[model samples]
Target: MNILTAMSSRLTVPFLDLKSQYRQHQAAFDGAMGAVIAEAAFAGGPWVERFEAEFAAYCGTTYAVGVANGTVALWMVLLAMGIGPGDEVITVPSSFIATAEAISFCGAKPVFVDIQEADCNMDPGLLKAAISSRTKAIIPVHLFGHPANMEAILAIAQEHGLPVVEDAAQAHGARYDGKMAGSMGLAGCFSFHPVKNLGAFGEAGAVITNDGELAQKLQRLRDHGQFEKYQHEVIGWNGRMDGLQAAVLSTKLPFLEERNAQRRQRAGWYFEQLGGIPDLVLPASLPEVEHAWHQFPVRIPCRDAVFAAMQGAGIGCSIHYPVPIHRQKAYHFLGLPEGSFPVAERCSREFLSLPIFPELTEEQVRTVTRVLKLWITRNHRVKNIAFSGKLAV
Candidate 1:
């Protein structure tokens, strides 16, 4: 290929850098994999057990049960809470579909709530209005690694006698009032998908809790209802995490704090560089909360045009969810029409997530922020200025 072609090929940046990550822990990861393989304990074995224990400790929880993936971890938590048929799980619609899907899997309805405008998390102010006798639990997803207003949510949950299941999939180390994301709820679910802060080689997840009985129930729920082999007591699904994935996770676990710190640092750089860019709204941090920086998402006007320009510029910008869960075809049966969730729908159309990973260098962060600012200002500045003038009139 010519230099031009090579340059064009190199222009595209990945949203996450698995290569740099593996390179950083090549020897340890390889050794952990080798150990798991040599032990021939591939399923629900010693390695997985060790990983779960370590992860629970990391999350500051008493128990952690490894599952096949984030979705299963969520489902298991709801099920173990005895939440099923004729129940409703209240959650925000701005998050990944898995948050609602897990509730639906248990024959429960998902009550969509609006998010706080700045953080794109479930707005605590909207919680009370959504509560009903059918509301068995509240699942607040720490969207984009910013911890939700858990203090308010917990107070509401306590008042309503609702169990709180945290979707901590995007927030591994985020803190609210000094309490870790997972540790704030009755149970918290985490995803070890490759893009997450503590991502594994493949799919892995865990359900964490301080409640011993709830933890035991979730363990059985993940292991085909058998605490011991052939002693199945309840109908359960085989959602155990793979030994290989657990081994990889164990190898990477110690680096999670450092990785999250780097992500925060990169986000700070983006904030500093992109803070004053017209038409671009950066993510916000509350005075009492610390965001894990899972994704440095921002909302901007002319989102579609800005997205196109970024893609054309060979930048790796993407939307977390361009469509809200209420608008998804699978949930159409719920009968929520367009604009039913105005805030979430608006968020879907306007929010964009720039590339964020600990492996991203300062140069890459600057490049992404620079491209985004240039695109938005170039395309929309005239209209925005005109609108401002009109508002003055």
Candidate 2:
């Protein structure tokens, strides 16, 4: 067999393996389901309430409202905070579109900001310049599960009397200055999609806050605006979390810390192996914050070539975001040009998310690193590629 044929027939590594996780925890999951079924509370019942309390405590907050999904959690937070038409919500441009979509859903315009190249998080220095009389809220995303520079952002928000809603969608157990991710700001929103560190079986999200009034407002908004059942006092939407999802989350929450530790260990392995590979840029991990390696995303000059090479070698890799939010077609109405956020746009072209999860064995990490090194060594011609600004994987 020739080198080409041998390279064509290699072991396949998945981006994540939820099936194995489910099978490993099948008994515990079955017991959780049995209890949920026996209670017969399928939608926003005791099961949901129980999980809400547990999650709120986990986040070090006094209240948590379980919503249908992360996007709705953002919308509900905006609505509960009375952010709507004619108001502007400031956030970085590289986060999931849901960050902006939630603000748009509440009739608010999302103001874009450029991110620091090192962390891919909102640059706190740019906050003041972007603030105006119309600016009402600041939503800083903990991109890639690394906490945002909250101290700086909070200072700016406080000076301007603006509320902050942390988009902790990718950061479940992340921390900044010894504070948990969802415990900061007026409120912090989380997503429990299947890929998240503490994911539920299906879509699930929560809004955690120390402010009781905001928490109560969220509770009412996630329901039908009824402070009491069948007593609607204001407009609301059906954003309730299903009981089964809550059960799944309850079973999963107890394991978050342990799983997060495993992810961190895996990150260390990646750094140890991939360090100093030419043309590769590793994102920063602030010494003061705890990074919850949700996705091991790296920036390389020719990310498309690196990603394609990994795929062809039967290794699973992905692009965290092929297009920054400001450049997306849906957000074109914001009237922002391609170069509005240059750093974010450049990152969109070069960002690559490698396979990462608590379940990834050390051997898998080695294989991924080995493949990356081999590809980078074999193809040292990225400087001459003349690539497009966006490389969709």
Best by lDDT: 2
TM match of model 1 to true structure: 0.94
- Candidate 2 per-residue lDDT, tens place, 1-393, comes to 322124537657799888877888899999998888998888899999999999988888999999999999999999999999999999989999999999999999999889997688999988899999999999999999999999999999999999999999999999999999978899999999989998989999999999999988988988999868899988899999999999999998988999999999999999998898778887789998999999999888778867876777778998979999988999988799988899999999999999889889999889888877866665554445553322222
Candidate 1 regions with alpha-carbon error over 4 angstroms: 1-10, 381-393
lDDT of 2 at 131: 98
TM-score of 2: 0.96
Clashing residue pairs for model 2: none
Candidate 2 off by > 4 Å: 1-5, 381-393
lDDT of 1 at 107: 96
C-alpha local distance difference test of each model = 0.86, 0.88
Maximum-TM-score candidate: 2
> What does the lDDT come to for candidate 1?
0.86
Query: What's the lDDT of the predicted structure labeled candidate 2?
Result: 0.88
The residue-by-residue lDDT of candidate 1 on 1-393, one tens digit each, is 322223335567667777887987799889999998998878879999999899988888989989999999999899888888999999998899999999999999999999988678899999999999899999999989999999999999999888898999999989999998988889999999988888988899999899999988988888899888899999998999999999999888898898888888998888888877666788888888888998878888767766766666578788999999989999999999997878889889888899988878898887777666655554564564533211111
